[model samples]
Target chain A: MEFNASLIGQAITFAILVWFTMKFVWPPLTRMMDERAARIADGLAAADRAKQDLANAEKASADRLREAKQQAAELIAQAEKRAAQIVDEAKDQAKVEGDRLVKGAQSEIEQQVQSAREVLRQQVADLAVAGAEKILKQEIDAARHADLLASIKAEL
Target chain B: MAAEQSATDYIVHHLTHAGLVPKTGAIFNFSNMHLDTFWVALALGFLFAGLFGYVARKATSGVPGRLQNFVELIVEMVDTQIKDAFHGKSRVIGPLALTIFVWVFLMNAMDFLPVDLLPAIAQAIGYYGFGHDPHHVYLRVVPTADVNQTFALSLSVLIIIIGFSIKAKGLLGWFKELLTAPFHAEGLGMQIVLGPVNLAFQIIELLAKPISLSLRLFGNMYAGELIFILIALLPWWINWVLGTPWAIFHILVVTLQAFVFMMLTIVYLSMAVEDH
Candidate 1:
């Protein structure tokens, strides 16, 4: 318990220990802690970036879906318009064909009627000549009867 | 019991140091080297350094082993304490505090071993190996309980304080502060008159720092050691009944004393570095 010189030895030892610890022990530990903190911060920042990327991708996909829907609608409208145009073209062709057929048939009928009229007129003229001849009970000159026949024909 | 043996002899025998006698008129006689104190203190210091050094060498950025975790916890604790108490930036103070705390705690913890254990072993070695008388063998295992040991630690802190003070304030400024601080007179004549008074007060204040610091730890540990020795004097069975509870209580004292020593050193150094 008495004061003695061993105090110096202890002091020197203490000083050496302090020096050793200051040089070796403390810096590494503090540095490690700082590094850990920095790493954690970096990780958090990366996570935030990933989250933002996910959101941006979601928005881009949504926009593409909306644009595709609009394009599909336009295509459907164009198809419908083309279908209507095809139907109208078919109707016009049918009408034109019907008009042509009707015209042709009318012309043929007119020709047939003409032919029948001609036959009828010929018969009528012959009948008139016969009647005149029977009444007179004599043969009339054929050249002189020509005017009567022509007149009969005109009247018919 | 031997015819010469008494309670006073027993206590004196326990208190004596085993060391070489200081040479007469030696300038370095102020440093009386105690073999027991040096050996115990150095051994414990090495233990602390080795453990911490191993941890430092194997330290990883990933999940740590149990030993690494424990070492890191201690490092963090001491770091936090230094941050809290020390106002100025110091590269040395953190490790210094750690060393002081751990070293002192280890020294003080030596008290928990049965009082006669090491001494008996030492006495046996001296008697059988060296052919020395067993009764002449002296060994005090608890280094911090020795005044010289505690004072050595405190005196080192005192040196740092002075060095820091001088560094913070120039030599002239530090001298002037020692002369005129904590008391000053308005007039030049009055100041001259009060110079010695202020210097005396300053010297006492400076000297008191180490004395109180060392004595506080030395006193507590010494008393604890004495109590253990007294308990040891009792019959073996009765010794357990008293020693167990005392040892448990002394555990707090051991840790607290170490904490006080480290805290005070930091505070003193902080004050030294600060202006005015």
Candidate 2:
């Protein structure tokens, strides 16, 4: 129980052990724990970011899909309107051509009628002259009947 | 009556240390060293270093192994006590506290071994292997039971306290504190008159820390060791009857003493570093 050099030896040993533990053992272990904590935190943050990114991408794609659908509907409506306008123009051109053809045909009929009427008038004049010649018995005063012929023509 | 005589002789023989004998038959010699206490303490210290060193080497940032968990538990326990007791910043106190707790606990735990086991082996080795008479081979395995070992540990703590006090307060500040604390006087005459009283009180207070710290552990362990020895004096059949109960009870004493020693050391160091 008495004090001796062994006490000094143990003290020195204690000091060395404390120094060794402080220098070698403590720092790395504590650093490992701290590093593990940091890694877990980073992983959680990255997961959160990835989740947010996925949501954003989904939203963007959905918006794009909606816009594309709206554009397609607009394009179909425009095509239908253009088709209706083309059909209307074709109908109007058909109506105008029919009207012109009808007018031309009417004009041709009137010309033919006028021509026939002239021919008829010529034949009638010949017959009337012959009867007059027979009735008057001679080539008397033909020049004097010219005014009647003209009046007959004006009446026709 | 012969059995009782032998039992008294047995307890006295076991109490004696295995060390150098002074020629004058005097037991108190400054040069004397307890070889058994020395060897056991060194072996346990190596064991502490080896186990902690292995864990330190294999330590990872990933999931820990069983050994790593156990080592970390001890480390954390000591670290918590240090954090609680020591408010000031220090690099040394944490490891120092850990070492003291583990080393002293291991030393005290040596008492749990059957009181006769190591000594009997040492006696056999002495008689057969070394050709020494068994009667001359005396060994005491529990190191903390020895006043010298416990005092040595407490003295080291005292030294650290003094070193930290000087480092934190400066030499002049420490000196002034010693001479003028627990009572203050402004005038030169009053200061001069109060200096010796303050110095005496401070010295006593400083001296009491190591003494109480060492004696508390030594007294508990030495008494426990004695009781174990006394229990061992019973006949073989009755030995277990008393021995088992005492051994179980001594476990708390052993662990508590170590904890108390470590806590007091941290408290002392904290006091040394903090301003008055």
Candidate 3:
């Protein structure tokens, strides 16, 4: 109730407490709080970046997969086309070989026919000459008969 | 009416301070000290400063524990109040407001203890431990109930306010504002005439801040403590009927007084910084 020296005491106490608080308490707490806020913001931004990277990687992998599928499809188509070309080439080769064989056999047959005709013509001429000599009843005029025989062979 | 004299004596005993007694004829003495108020307030101040210091030392930017959250809640609350009220920049104002609010609040909270608990214990120690007369041992636990304590805190605020005014505006500027403020004049002669008037008003205003600040907290806590003492004087069985309600109401009074003291301090400082 009375005004006393305790007032001064309390005032000194108050001042010292305030000084202690200013020096030790307020700055560190506020600094820590601000730092914590910044850290949280950084963490959130990092998370967002990670998510974006994941999406980008997913898109890149999808593109690579699509490209591989296209390449595989192109390779399969080329293989099929190559296989078809090989089959066509084999068929054409077989046909050409058969034609050659047929042609060769035909030529041989034609040659044989020509030789037989010559042999038949020679026999016919010999027979004809013999028959004429028999009819003329002599080996007279053999030189004149040779010229006739040559003309007959030419006609055959 | 049989218990009337004893009732008065009991109330006076509870109201008395455990400190140096003034000389017989002197009504106001500077040598007298309220040791109970001094020790209690000092201890509470240390408790506040110590705990907050501990928290600051271990404070992490990572996830906070419950205790850290609680401390942060209070610190942020005080910070918000300061930021709202104080426009000027000063490092002292924040810590000043925190100390006033927390220290005063702790002081006020001392009123919640049973009115005679500490006194009785002290009396027992004096009687048995020291072989002293128990009747002479007086202890008033709540420091804010003391006018000296509240006045001390508010006067400290007053000093700080003056310091802030001087810092915000230099000494010449502060003095000039004091002499020319709240009433402006066109000519130098007119201004000179109004200067003394303004100075008178300024002194009154300066004195009023501390007077009001100290008295408001002192009155509330003092009245509350008195009421508690009165309630203890009632029959033990029926004490709760009035005690419970008064205690509940006093809780609001205690917190509101502390908050008012802090807010007024910040407002006054802000006002000191601004021109008329």
Candidate 4:
């Protein structure tokens, strides 16, 4: 096909305009946009990684807290058991000491009773001699009191 | 009779642009007017910006919804292309390919609209606002379909390739490449035959890039546009029969043009970034 002058003109015009656009218009704009796009992608990736890390840390902390609570409960149970055992031992020891002390006091009381009876008997003997002297003129009562005390002792 | 003349006139009028014509030898002529080409491109650019910008701005961190995912898929594909084909780090190339792909696609996509849709509206306003004939309205939207647009793109890539060649091979290196490359045979007498072969190869390779780049976009789109116009030319009754399939198939054309342009741009940039 025959080429036209106008077509040639159009072609030249197109070449010039394209050169102008490439040099002046397209370069800076595309550069800035590409940079922005790269930055945005990087920012998004960082955010995702950070979120994952945060979730992992939170789960780890929760697990640690649960484990700590279990340990604390076990320690408390052990302490309570130890305290109850010590209290039971003290109660048993106090009961044994009370029984021993009661037995010793009973033996001491029996010994005191025996000594008081002997003293009372001696006093009765003296009282009988005095009564005999008063009733049957004094010289004969002394000899009768000795016989009366001896007989009273034998009868008791 | 008047209607035919006027119809022809309207097409001729739309065909002519508000740009300066070369007085034959001018390498480049810039048009300050048609603020239309610049503004239209800018507006389309922003429209793209807004649609995609909204997707980016509203993107959820979770699975991307349909619109955002679709856009991201395209962007990733574009990026992977640049990464795969282009050598070295080009902070500028990936997005440049993106812009070219999107801009050209948008330009070509304009053809899909009823060819008369915009001009029809223009004529309506012209009838009242400017007190002109409605049939005289003219407009052409697809910039790449405009040969100047495609050539301009190819030339820019051409300049970039030149720059890369210079940067990679110093002037001395460039000269050495041209004179001594394709050093085919090592035998002492084979040097004579090698010279011509090397020269031809060099010439062929040098001519290949711009021609291929320019023609590839031009051929596909021009053919696609031609098919559309031909289909549109069909009678109303027959249109229904052929139109649906053509239009459905054209969607593939639209998507393919965009993909091809994107891949080629990446390939060219990759070549630019290479040492060879």
Per-model C-alpha lDDT, please? 0.85, 0.85, 0.89, 0.64
- Let me know the DockQ for model 3: 0.56
Chain A accuracy as TM-score for every candidate = 0.62, 0.68, 0.69, 0.60
Write the number of the candidate with greater DockQ, choosing between 2 and 3: 3
Q: What is the C-alpha RMSD of each candidate to the true structure, in Å?
A: 5.0, 5.5, 4.2, 5.8
Candidate 4: tens digits of C-alpha lDDT, residues B1-276? 123455455445544433433223344444322333444455666666556556655655455578866766666677778778877765556556766777777777876776556656666787889997654444455555555566656766666666666676787776556655667567757766676777777677766876777677778766765665555556657865776787778778777877787687678666654544
Instruction: Compute DockQ for each candidate against the true complex.
Output: 0.34, 0.33, 0.56, 0.08
Between prediction 3 and prediction 4, which has the larger DockQ? 3
lDDT of 1 by residue, A1-156 (tens): 456678777888998888888877777877776676688889899999999999999999999999999999999999999999999999999999999999999988898888888888778767766777677655667687778767876786
DockQ of 1: 0.34
**Cα lDDT of model 2 by residue, B1-276, tens digit:** 126358767887788788765323543566777788888998998898888877888898778888888888888888888888898888888778888999999999999998989998998999899999776789999999887788889888888999999999999999999999867999999999999999999899888999999999999999999999988777889889999989999989989999999999999999999887
Per-residue C-alpha lDDT of model 3 across residues A110-156, encoded as one tens digit per residue: 99898888888888877777777788867637686678778976886
Clashes of each: 3, 0, 0, 8
Model 2 CAPRI rating: acceptable
Instruction: Give candidate 1 misplaced runs (Cα > 4 Å).
Output: A52-156, B1-13, B21-32, B234-240
For candidate 3, the chain B TM-score comes to: 0.96
lDDT of 2 by residue, A15-78 (tens): 8878877877776666666777798899999999999999999999999999999999999999
TM-score of 1: 0.79
Instruction: Candidate 1: give the clashing pairs.
Output: A5-B31, A5-B32, A6-B32
